[model samples]
Structures are given as C-alpha cells and as structure tokens.
Target: MDPRLTLVVISSCIALCLGCTKELSVGELFYGSVIETKSSPSAKHCQILCTYELRCAIFTFSNFKCELKRDDSGAIRAVSSSIISGRSLFSCAAEKKEACFRDEYSQVAFKDKPYQTVRTTNEKECRSKCDNDPLCSFYTFYKSSAQCELKFWNLLPTAEVLYSSTGNLVSGYSSKLKLNINAKYNCLSIQSKGYLLENDYFDYTYSGAAFTVEHCQTLCNLNPFCRVYAYRTNGHCRLKLIKDSHTQGAKLDYVISGLRQTDCKPNFVGKKTTATT
Candidate 1:
C-alpha cells in the first residue's frame, strides 16, 4: 500500500473505533485577576499564554490586555466588567471519550414552561452556563433576543416536534461528556433547524439535499462552525456556516432554524508541557 494510503487507513480505523484512547486536560479555570497588561488580541490568546507558563494556573483578558496568575491566593475579583478568566486544564484529565451527537436541523421542545431563564450573549455561552449549573439540562436559545430558556428534566427530554428553518431560535443539550476532536476550534454549534428562500435571499449555502431534519443536524454537527441551517420537509437540506452573531434574529416559517451545541473548545498550548513534563 502507498504510504499516504496506509496513513489514511490507520486514521480511519482509529476514528471508527469507539474505544480509541484520547488525551484531554482535566484542568478547570477557578478564577483570575489582572496582573499586567500585555499586547494581545482576544481572551483565547491569553488562555494560550497561560497554558504555556509553568506556574500559570489562571489568566484574565480584558480591553486588549492580558493578566496571568499562578494561583487564586488573593481576593478573587474581576478588574472590570470586561475581564474574562480561564484556567489550565492540566489538573483535570480526559478519559475514554464518547461520541457527540446533536440534532442540527431539528430541536426537541417541551410544552412545559422553562424552569429557569438566564441572560447570555450567545448560544455557546448559554450552553456553558447550563452545563455549569446543577439544575439545567435542556435549553432553548433565541438568537434575536439573546435570551436562553433553561429547562430541567429528571430524564431525557422528548416532546413536541416543532421545527423552524429561517428563525434564529435554536435548542441544545447541556455539555456533559462529549468527545473532543483534538483540533483547535474557536466556535461550536450544538443544534439548529429550518430551510427555504432558494431563488436568492441568502447565497452562502455550500450544498443542498433532499434531507430530513435529523440528517441536516448530523451535517451541522460534523462542522465545527456550522450552527445555522435551513431544512425543508421536501428533503431539501441547506447547510450554512453563518456563525453565531449576537444581532441575528428569527426568520419566516418557510425556513427552520438551528444553533450550534456549545461554544469554542478552550484551546491551550501549554497543555502538552503541563501534562507530559
């Protein structure tokens, strides 16, 4: 066999095996404070810096500034409203991963009223909030409203089959234990639904198919950034890459809407040193 083909075969087999071992950082961000202002672009950058530092247990980023810390030994306070904090995951470790599945082109809604309501900036943040909260399990996100409707269930949620294609409304599950692909990604979508306006309204669709809502969702789940999609009952599947935007709103009934499952997977460059060394 050709060397490249052999490599591809090995890769495929590894991905196909459900029991494949995966390395993950078990670290969690406790808290952080502004230690110094260093030129940086975003909070992700600061996180990468903390991952590289030997003692950097936590980090904060705000107003184009980066602050790194060794531990939360002092009063845990935010420098300002803009400060974003994160911690290294070396302390936490990844075990055998599970397959992650989300309905990209469909959502499960309950007739029961939302148990709690939490304010958030986007879909990913809302999912994280739900994952962290002990009481939350299922949630619906209104993209136009920037509102997250958190719902709790003693068991799995299986209810009404309401679907939307062009609307900004989306639903998702809490982040429990899903497999990490090991690639660095900045955005993630848990689920979405809806499709239409084919002549020429939104022209960014990469492909179309005679697909069902469930099929559309699987396509979206395969992509790291595809949170939105339009699906029709006629089997027309329209894949979209229009990422999370705080300003986008719900659309017409002819279209069904979908949203991504979670936010960006926290990236760390220092994880290797911290874990292996």
Candidate 2:
C-alpha cells in the first residue's frame, strides 16, 4: 500500500471507532453550553448531526429541535418527558435503538376510551398487544376481567386523563410517546385510606381522574390555584382551595388526600375529625 493511503485509512478507522462509542440517555434535558441549534426529525438524527459537528460534545433534542452543547460537565440535567439528550463521540456512526417503557401505575386506568380492547390472560400479554400495535401509546389491564384496553390519541394525554381505579387495574405508557409525568412538588404528608381537610370553607374547585396519589399531587402542583388534593381509590381526584387557616376532616374508605408543601400557608393547618356516616 502507498504510504499516504495507509495513513489516511488509519485516520478514518480512528474516527469511525470514536463515533461508535456514543451512547444515548433518554428522558433527560441538559441545560447550558449550547454551541449550535438545528431542526431534527428525531433524537437519532439529532445525535447523528452532533457526531459530525466537531464542536458538539452533547446534544438535547425535543419537539423537532436539536441543541448542540460544548460542555456537559456543569450542565443541569432535568427529567423531561419530551426531551432526549446524549453525548457525542465526534464522528458519524449508526444509531443504537432499544425498547423503552415508563414505569407502570397499579390500580390506575385511563379515562379516555381505548382504541381497541382485547381479552388477554395476563398483564404481560396485554402489554405485548400494545407493543405490537403501531397506534397504541398507552394501555390499561384489568386483572379481574382479564382484559386489555389499548389506548391511542393524536397526541399524548395529560395526567388528567388517568384515574385511580380498582386494585386489579394497571396502566402504563410507552416512553416513545414522551408523556409529561415529571412535575416538581413536595408533599407535607400523605393521608391514606381516608380523606382529610374536607369542610365548607375549603371547597373543592374541581375533580378529575388520577392514576395515583402522586399523579394527583402533580396536577395540584401544576395548578397555581390548587392548595390541596384528594384522591380516591375509585380513580377520583379533587383539587381544592382553602381560605381558612384551620380545616376539618372526615373518614372515607379508599380515599387519600394531602397538602402541597409549597401551598402550606403559615396559618393553614389540617384538623382531623371523626365522622359517623
């Protein structure tokens, strides 16, 4: 081989090897040190573009936009449902793909009607059916009835679509759909198997279905006006606003409630009281 050609081949191999080491981290959004921005159709494409950009060290892709970053060392990593972030290896390489799914919520179901219903022997089979269907984005499995409900929508549904249900129900979403499940909030405390702080002064603003008590708390946290939340095992969530510093409570089976730590006013306090129904 010619000396010049031999040197060129060795350089090409090094570049290829460098690119093959890049790995992806899904559901993470990295902030700062953006060197450039480009429109990409997918996370994989954004990663490929980063590999070709000499200055790109890391990239975050979301909603068809890609941001190339120079330094990820001090960058803040936030959990996001839509954003996908990865570090680049400074050379072009094939994108790696993998099966990804979000954690499942027990005793939960989607309020929206499923696109298709199939009778399955177990939750695994139900999940398999959803995995095989191109249109399925989320699903609910009823253990008692041995039925799977495959759900679909033009876009991913919000947390409001989920509701607490029978103990036999379970629900989950595909990570590819990128549903927003990570909301920042802290609970002062969670009361289980009963509702608290229900009184005339603290009337509920509205009610909806929540997949879990945490889901209900997320909804309350996102609502600027929400001060307290109550969740029932039957898949019901109630958001409330309380003006009084003192509140009363009652016993209700299969119900849980709590106050958001951020919303706990200095004067506001919960007073649990027994009720005979």
Candidate 3:
C-alpha cells in the first residue's frame, strides 16, 4: 500500500474507534430523560460533554446550555434556531479528549430572574460564579458595566419564556446540573388515539390483521424487541422495534399508536407456543 493511503486508513480507523463524528440536528430539542446538564459554548463542545459521559447517548444544546440525555428515545421537539441536538458515536474508553470553553449568548439576557448580582471582568468568570453556586440556574453578563447577574427559578418555566434579546448582554446556564431520575415517572404507559407515527420506525418486525388496538398491543407485548405498535381501524396491526428507546409517532386519521411502558422480557417455554386470540 502507498504510505499516504496507509496513513489515511489508520486515521479513519482511529476516528471510527473513538466515535469522532457526530450527527447534529439543528433546531431540535429532546424532551425529558435528562441525565445531566452543563453550560456549553457551542454545539461541538456539547458533543464533547456527551462523549465523556458513559450513559449519554444524545444531547441538546441551547442558550449556552447542554442537556445530556441517556438515549434518542425521547420526543424530539422543534425549537428555536439556537437549539442543536445530536448523538455521540464515541465510546467511553476513547483516548481523544478536549477542553471545554465558556459558551455565552451575546446580545441576550435572561430577564427578571436575577437572584444574585456580582462584578466580573468577563463572561467566563461570570459563568464560573453560576457553576459554583448550587441555586444558580443561569446568568447574564453586561459588557459595558462589567456586571454579572446570577439567576435561579423557584419553579422552572417553559422554554419559550426563558430568555430575551438585549444588546451588550451575554447569558448562559450553570456548568453542571445533575437531574434526579424517577423511574416510575420515566416508565409511564403511553397511548395516543388517532395517530400514526411516520418515518420514525427502527424496524417493522410484524404486520397482520388485528381485531382491535388492544389486540395489536398484545402482539407487541409478545415480541421481545417490540417497543411500539400502531393499529388501523381497517384491522391492520403493525409492530415496531426500537431497542431500549420509546417511540414517538405522528397523528393520522383512523389510526391508533402506543408505546410499551415496560421493557420486553421474554420467557421461553420448553416448546415454542403459538399465540391465540
């Protein structure tokens, strides 16, 4: 082999092994199931944070904050242009690592929510204050006055009302925010009437005539890999599989879809048993 070609092959292999490449979806936000949150300066920095955590499979970056999610199973919501969501392809054991820079939103301010105001030379130092303070959720820095305002919410508000645009202001979230996962809440029974989740299937394992939606659910329940099912009024049943992630579907007329609350655990009998009505 040519020496240049050999080097190229070696580099490619190393990149794949470390999962250097990431798949980013701009203007997307994954709801719920956040394992951890941190302040990030850019989408690329957010990906690095996701890569560092063993449990982080996907992440969403918005308003200079990075939300690390356990998987891609959560509902993906289209949000503002600032939001960027992506999946990490790297393994936890990868050798390559990078330092994180302070992420800030210029000409933006988080309004009417400052709990503590302090003096700081730059946004990086301002961010450090928020990172150290447990109560701080976000902070805004004023460029001309060199003022840093650390803010926290008594109750978290909706994303729409989180930030506002202003000149000479920079804002960002805390560097680290660990979320408590309630297993019971995360594993709730999900059912949607009159909807068909389109183009979101991992695999279409089985499809056949089913009497009712309940019957289609039963079919999904029996399959070890099936995580979601869709039933049509015309008696067609479709079972889909997405291992270890919840499935989100779109709405369509005359269709019903649902997600299996619990993981599919199959118990094998002495012989293969036939499923009956």
> Which segments of model 3 are wrong by more than 4 Å?
1-18, 27-42, 45-49, 60-68, 72-83, 89-93, 109-116, 120-139, 150-161, 172-277
lDDT (C-alpha) at residue 161 in model 2: 35
Better of 1 and 3 by TM-score: 3
What is candidate 2's lDDT per residue for 230-263, written digit by digit as tens?
8766546688767652467777676777775464
Q: TM-score of each candidate?
A: 0.28, 0.30, 0.34
Rank the candidate models, highest lDDT first: 3, 2, 1
By lDDT, the best candidate is 3
Runs in model 1 with CA error above 4 Å? 1-111, 157-159, 177-277
How many Å off is the CA of 250 in candidate 1? 56
Q: Give the per-residue lDDT of model 3 (tens digit) for 62-157.
A: 866888876455478888888898865443234323222345667666665677899999998999998898657678888889999987642221
- lDDT of all predictions, in order shown? 0.46, 0.58, 0.59
Mark the 10 consecutive residues where model 3 has the least summed lDDT. 265-274
Task: Give lDDT: candidate 1, residue 230.
Answer: 60
lDDT of 1 by residue, 163-252 (tens): 455567667656652423223344553332332323322654545542235445444444444545565544454655553433254545
Give the RMSD in angstroms, all C-alphas superposed, for model 3: 17.0
The numbered model that scores best in TM-score is 3
TM-score of 3: 0.34
Better of 1 and 3 by lDDT: 3
lDDT of 1 at 21: 22
